[model samples]
Target: MVIGILKMDICLPHLHSLKDKRKVLKSLMAKLRQKFNISVAETGGQNKWQRSSISVVLTCNDSGFAHQVLEGVVREVENTIEGFLVKYEIEII
Candidate 1:
């Protein structure tokens, strides 16, 4: 099995409250889980509204699939989040 992990740092420009931040994060997480069949969550920067970090993990029989899925998830994050800027790192094991 191949495990692909992606760590992403996302910046939300207008986030003010934890509730609002969580709502947005949850929506994005749900979408990623449902669409990519992967596990994703907020791994860091939970308190701050303008900055957040998410880690996404995908396990599959093929490495190529993992890579493809990671790419798709990154694209989706970019498309789904408004005024979102992201820095990401990906690893396969």
Candidate 2:
């Protein structure tokens, strides 16, 4: 099996509270899981209300498929989140 992991740093411009941050993060995570069949969560920057770093893990039988799926998920995230900027890195193991 091939495992693909992607770590993304997302910046939310107008998030004011932890509740709002959690709600946005939850919605983004749900969308990622539903659309790409991947597991995503906030791996870092959780204590702050404006910035979040989310990590996504995708497993598949083929490395190529895993990469494709990760790429698709990244694109989906970029398209779905408004005024959100992301810096991401992907690794296959």
Candidate 3:
């Protein structure tokens, strides 16, 4: 099996408090999980209101497929997220 992992750093310029951050993160996480059928979580920058890091993980029988899925996920995030995606990294194992 091939495991694909994607880590994304995001900047929420409109958020003014942690509550707003949680709301945005929760909605984003739920949408990502439901749409991609992948595991998603807040992996870093939890205490900051304007910045956050999320990790997406998926497993597939083929490495090429795994890479494609990760790429698709990245595209989806870039298009749908309410904030700016600062950077991202993908790994396959």
Question: What's the best-to-worst order under lDDT?
Answer: 3, 1, 2
- Best by the lDDT measure: 3
What TM-score would every model get versus the actual structure? 0.95, 0.93, 0.95
Q: Which stretches of candidate 3 lie over 4 Å from their true place?
A: none
For model 1 the local lDDT of residue 61 reads: 91
- Ranking 1 against 2 by TM-score, winner: 1
lDDT tens digits, residue span 1-93, model 2: 899999889888888988999998899899888888888989999899999999999888999999888889888888877647568998999
| Lowest-sum lDDT 10-residue window in model 1 | 81-90
The lDDT of model 2 is 0.88
Give the Å shift of residue 73 in candidate 3: 1.1
**How well does candidate 1 match the true structure in TM-score terms?**
0.95
Query: Can you give the lDDT of residue 88 in candidate 3?
Result: 95
Q: Which one is best on TM-score? A: 3
Task: Write candidate 3's Cα lDDT for 42-77 as tens digits.
Answer: 999999999999999999899999899889988988
Residue 27 accuracy (lDDT) in model 1: 92
